[model samples]
Target: MEMLSGAEMVVRALQDEGVEYIFGYPGGAVLHIYDALFQQDTVNHILVRHEQAATHAADGYARSTGKPGVVLVTSGPGATNAITGIATAFMDSIPMVVLSGQVRSDWIGDDAFQETDMVGLSRPIVKHSFMVRDPRQIPEMIKKAFYIANTGRPGPVLVDIPKDHTAPHNTFPYEYPKKVKMRSYAPVTRGHSGQIRKAVDELLKAKRPVLYAGGGVVQGEASQALTALARKLNFPVTNTLMGLGAYPGSDEQFLGMLGMHGTYEANMAMHNADVILVAGARLDDRVTNDARKFCPGAKIIHIDIDPASISKNVAAHIPIVGPVKQVLEEMLTMLDEQGEVGTDTKSLERWWQEIAGWRKVHGLRYETNEQGPMKPQQVVQALYKATKGEAYVTSDVGQHQMFAAQHYLYDRPRQWINSGGLGTMGFGLPAAMGVQFAHPDAVVACVTGEGSIQMNIQELSTCLQYGLPIKIININNQALGMVRQWQDMQYGGRHSQSYMESLPDFVKLAESYGHVGMLVEKLEDLDGAMEEAFALKDRLVFMDIYVDPTEHVYPMHIADGSMRDMWLSKTERT
Candidate 1:
């Protein structure tokens, strides 16, 4: 075996770990890592305009492909810029490895230029972090970082290496460990039999039962197991925003979503349930409007891989800590053993009838005038039809996001990728790029508002350079839609600076980047324009549609209000 420099060793380790691409920015302290990267032709690197976008793109990559995203940045501000992206990934349970260059080992305490205590700063947001004071620890640390980032609930991990250590001599041998050892890191293999039995008994005895699913289903790849459990038990299932595609919306037992903007029937089910088998959901405040009154009569059985997530925000009757897939699989097996599982046919029929009536009464409908602005719901519905529910749809944070979540029907898990926990605005375009990069064969769409798209518009360059085929559908309302909605409803109809004075021709802007751009003015133009956007191969396409900014997402739980106070419609607010 040939010896290699510390930097070279890192490159070799990354290649060994199956990392094909790394998103990063170059700087002084990390020049050696970049130099080594330049020498090796195997791994591809995409340079982002901002360090934050790099980590966010990495997060999007990891979330889309179920692989550990790799991000590289230099000292101080470079490292700090990556903090938000890392925190986003941490909160969402996306696996990523953030490698940041540091000041030289000797210059660390001397307040060297571009120096910062990166490891300490990133500690809370990462699953694990390490500062390599010695070059010999590089190989082990890299191996351990990958293990930690991919295992358990999966989150970001940081590896900080000083400038001197990057060029250390080649005496250290490279041995990739098969596993990592941690004293406090034993994950549960399966659901506890007693706990699963108790949960089954609770469900069997309860008159009204609801299955609450969350992002943990997608994060843990437990969608199939979750579906099996829901179907076998014959209970209606409702998902949090992050858990949109976990349960099929068309399923008889499925209730659309549960939150402020969730379905009326779903919220009613949560309010009246005698027991809630909360699998993979954390019961966020958005999901549980008034925590004290949430699921008033229900005894919640909370099952999650993260022990801290259980009973942290909302109390639980039974907390089972285990991998979601494992717990769900075990629960399914136990239910099968109980024999002849069937739904409360009469209760289920009544529930479905009520939900169907609610659906018709408050259906997502809008008028198209063929002249002025398109309703936001109309834009989403047209796009949804054009894509045929076969695209990896990612969104930026805004009214468009909530609208897409509420109106769009995603058939399978992992299709709806967006910032759920953090609600970060600039996440859409970069995330869509990352998603396309990870799943090259799939048709991917990035849904964002004009305000949100401007945050990281430079990613268009990355898409062009990489030849990533992405369809960017911008809801160009020329206003901050979400803020405008809130303001219109609560602020005495006084429209503030939410509307911009002048707007750029987004089609021309895309053309400036040598991308094929299209604009739609009529309801009928949507399908044709989307078709053209999809027909273009090996290039990015941009579709800018002007939407009515006055549109607002309803059935919302306002501050200090119970689920009973949900607006439920455009004409009502409690």
Candidate 2:
């Protein structure tokens, strides 16, 4: 082992792990490490506009590439600002490693300048955290962090290195562990073979079956396996919002996204199915308004990597706790061995016919398209057409997110990235940047609402600095669309604190940031604007679309109601 300074060891350890990007910002506590990074060539550090954006960029990188996203931040506010991003990743189960610089070890408890208890502050959101007291612990701690972050039920991990540890006066022997094994934390990888057979038995016996999935299928890289199994059984599939791209959205068997603001057919199928084969999804409150009343007739077969997730909210008759990809692949193998399905095929045919009727009752069809302001639903479709359904699309939360999920048909995994659980606003721009960084030649777009986009609009400078040409689709409804819809439904139309007055001109704002900008107000101009924005391959284009302010997301779930019960349109609201 060669002697190296603590800062050098930090950089070297990252290089050893094959980390290509480090999303972070610089400060006094991390100066030495930044200096060491400046002297390196293999690992590139991306300077983000805010510490929160750094964590989100890393999240996007991890979600798209299947590698643990790395982050570096100073103490105090640097670490605290990243809590939302960390929580977002935690709630969604994205793999990430966050390296934070701390105050001197001797001054830690004395509350030195720029010092805060990062470990305690982030403990609730992170999968695990470490405080480095010795310079010798750097390499191994990093190894442990990555290992913990990317394993089963992937989430963010934090490593807090005291400034004293990285002092220039210190030197230590460094070696990254080839492989790490922690006796206390060995996650189960393979499901029980007997359980697989039991699940198969249940699957083959059902006539009306729905293959419901969530983010787990994508995070576990089981999308292909899931697709194969669903096609083999000819079962109708529905995805949660986070699970949008897990199944081919354009396929005939896909019933579209299910739950609140989901498609009519998908929600109906879940409510009416005789059996529900759930994969990689914990039926969250967003999907199941009243867990006690969710799919009472369906026998649930749940597959998850975490045992605790199974039946935590909804009862699972067949709970298989293992990695989703392995479990699905094993199930496919057993199907092959069984040779042929002996169940009544006529029942499935009738089931499909019923689903087809619900499909025709979809909420995506506009009420009136010929007059008045542009529709956000049409904007999402125009974006899909402009990119030929090939762009890496990311979005902030709200009406636009739901619209994107309902209209933009994703044919492959990792194409649709957004904050599903935490519903964090301002995730789109930085996430788009990270996605573009991962696939430089591929088209990238950020579908954002006016309220959500303003949360992190300053990232435009970072985009210019990095030469990332991402299309920004701004759906300007001149109001907090979702908030207004809810307030209107629940509070007798009290528009207090919901209407967004005096919105800035997004076109001028984009130009001020040194990027191309255009305003699309007419329905006829929507497609043309999207096509033009995408044609500017070397420049970032911001398309500010003025959609109908009165439009609200359809198929909204009723309170204390089943999945099939929904407000299909504004007229049906409460």
The residue ranges of model 2 lying beyond 4 angstroms of the native Cα positions read none
Q: Can you write out model 2's per-residue Cα lDDT over 1-574, one digit (the tens) per residue?
A: 7888889999999999999999999997888899999998999999999999999899888878889999999999998988899999999999999999999899998989999999999999999999998999899999999999999899999999998899877798878899998989998989998998899889888989999999999999999999999988889999998888899999999999999888889988999888898999999999987888898799999999999899999999999999999999999999888788555478889999999998888666777568788889989999999999988999999999999999999988899999999999999998888888898999999999999999989899999999999999999999998899898889898988988889998999999999999999899988888888999999999999999988888989998898888898877642
Candidate maximizing lDDT: 2
TM-score attained by model 1: 0.96
Q: Model 1 segments beyond 4 Å from truth?
A: 168-171, 342-346, 363-372
Model 2 CA lDDT for position 488: 84
Which number leads on TM-score?
2
Cα lDDT, all candidates: 0.83, 0.91
Least lDDT summed over 10 consecutive residues: which range in candidate 1? Answer: 359-368
Q: Which pairs, if any, clash in model 2? A: none
Q: Give the TM-score of candidate 2.
A: 0.99
Poorest stretch of ten by lDDT in candidate 2: 360-369
Number of clashing residue pairs in every model?
Answer: 0, 0
